[model samples]
Target: MPLSRTVRCICIEISKKRFNPKSLEKLEIIPASQSCQHIEIIATMKKTGEKRCLNPESKAVENLLKAVSKERSKRSP
Candidate 1:
């Protein structure tokens, strides 16, 4: 099979001062040496076996949920 890449949501936080465009390469090795004090990348995924509660009233969120349900319902029925 051809290689496929899965898209995962990632959130990155870099400190205010060191985020300047020029210093990105220089700051790679050393976190402290760079003007930015801390950088954090978090992948926010629901924990296993946990139910994801959705507010049906939300237009955008509910639309996504409806799309998923519709796809499954189509396959089954």
Candidate 2:
């Protein structure tokens, strides 16, 4: 709706009677993560007090973290 000339106050409502939410929902664009989904991993780590950081490759730190977690579990009281 385009109005030419001057106007006082123009209120356009598109929720209840005018526009559909489904059509508008289809127009939204979002980015997705590649490889493993990071958000889930982050949330899990937050609960368990574990943090994951990016390393140069999956060789050094990845193996290091797994070994540390395994060693930590092996430690006795």
On the 0 to 100 scale, the lDDT of residue 30 in model 2 is 19
Query: lDDT values of the candidates?
Result: 0.32, 0.30
lDDT of model 1 at position 25: 20
Residue 41, model 1: Cα distance from true site in angstroms: 17
lDDT per residue for candidate 2 within 1-77, as digits (tens), equals 88633232122211222222222211211122453222121111223443233222324334445666899989954
TM for every model, in the order presented, reads 0.26, 0.25
- Candidate 1 lDDT over residue span 1-77, tens digit each: 66323222122322222222222221112222233343322111233332222222334344444766999999995
Q: How far out, in Å, is residue 70 in model 1?
A: 0.4
The 10-residue segment of model 2 with minimum total lDDT is: 21-30
TM-score (C-alpha, index-matched) for candidate 2? 0.25
Count of clashing residue pairs in every prediction: 0, 0
- Best of the candidates, TM-score: 1
